[model samples]
Target: MGNIVKERKSRPVNLDIKTIRFPITAIASIMHRVAGVITFVSIAILLWLLSLSLSSPSGFETASAIVDSFFVKFVLWGILTALAYHIVGGIRHLMQDIGYFEELETGAKSAQVAFALTGVLSVLAGILVW
Candidate 1:
């Protein structure tokens, strides 16, 4: 006699990423990725600013005017904030790779500390920019 095999039914798919609760480490990792992308894009803006400032006297004046704008200052502040976060996150990653904060509890705590440091430095960056 041949035995029958049973097939299990698949569950419905949930496509919303927002419905999931991510851990602090996961959030920090995602933020680190986003900050890296922001920093990469900011490089083009920086280069343009540099070129405008260094090309000629008129160019320098134009660059100065652009830099003096409130919107430009805000954008620069955001870029700097992203840079600060990316740097802090990178340091934490490096330490982890070197065997520090390897445990789950310690890793989570480090993530929290990195975020706090980022917040403080972001405020400082905003202050300096304004």
Candidate 2:
């Protein structure tokens, strides 16, 4: 155990992120985590908007006006995109847990499919937001 610890300590660590090339599955997994965080943070913004819209008649109009802005629309699109990606990634993970796409080739293909689905969803979300 001591020798193993010494050996591990002697190994060089690559801290340069740009130089690292992650596999497709790893990239998909990382993006899924990022999307989850975005979705979680977006809940606050969405709740605030909902509260504003429900507060009173004037508040509804104010919320509508705020949502009509280009920047707010863009932010909404981003939130939707993240939500879509997170859902797709979650499905992929569930499939994996069920003993599907456990092989290297199949896993990569699933990751690719997830990326494509996310792209399509993002485009649809952009259209909806705009």
Candidate 3:
């Protein structure tokens, strides 16, 4: 055990991200986590909008005006894009949990499909937002 520990401690470690190459599945998984975070943060903005719209009539008008701005529309588009990606990634995870796409090749293919679907959804979201 002592010798094993010493050998393990002596092994080389690569910590530079620039030198690292991530597989498609790994990238997909990382993006899924990022999208989840974006979605979580966007919830606060959405709730604020909901609250404003549900307030007095003037508040509703204010919310409507805010939503009509180019910046707000772009933000909405980003939120929708993140949500779409998160949902796609979530379905992939569910399929994996059910024993599908366990192999490396199949997992990569599933990630690719998720990415493609998210791309299409993002385009649609952009169109809808604009």
| Each prediction's RMSD to truth | 2.9, 3.2, 2.8
Candidate 1 Cα errors over 4 Å, as ranges:
1-6, 9-18
Clashes of each: 0, 0, 0
Instruction: Looking at model 1, report the run of 10 residues with the lowest lDDT sum.
Output: 12-21
Candidate 3: give the clashing pairs: none
Over 1-130, each residue of candidate 2 has an lDDT whose tens digit, in order, gives: 3555434457789999999999999999999999999999999999999999999999999999999999999999999999999999999999999999999999999999999999999999999999
lDDT of 1 by residue, 26-47 (tens): 9999999999999999999999
Q: How accurate is candidate 2 locally (lDDT)?
A: 0.97
What do the candidate models score in CA lDDT, each in turn?
0.96, 0.97, 0.98
**What would the per-residue lDDT of candidate 3 be over residues 1-130, giving only the tens digit for each residue?**
3555434457789999899999999999999999999999999999999999999999999999999999999999999999999999999999999999999999999999999999999999999999
- Poorly placed runs, candidate 2 (over 4 Å): 1-17
Clashing pairs in 2: none
TM-score of 2: 0.87
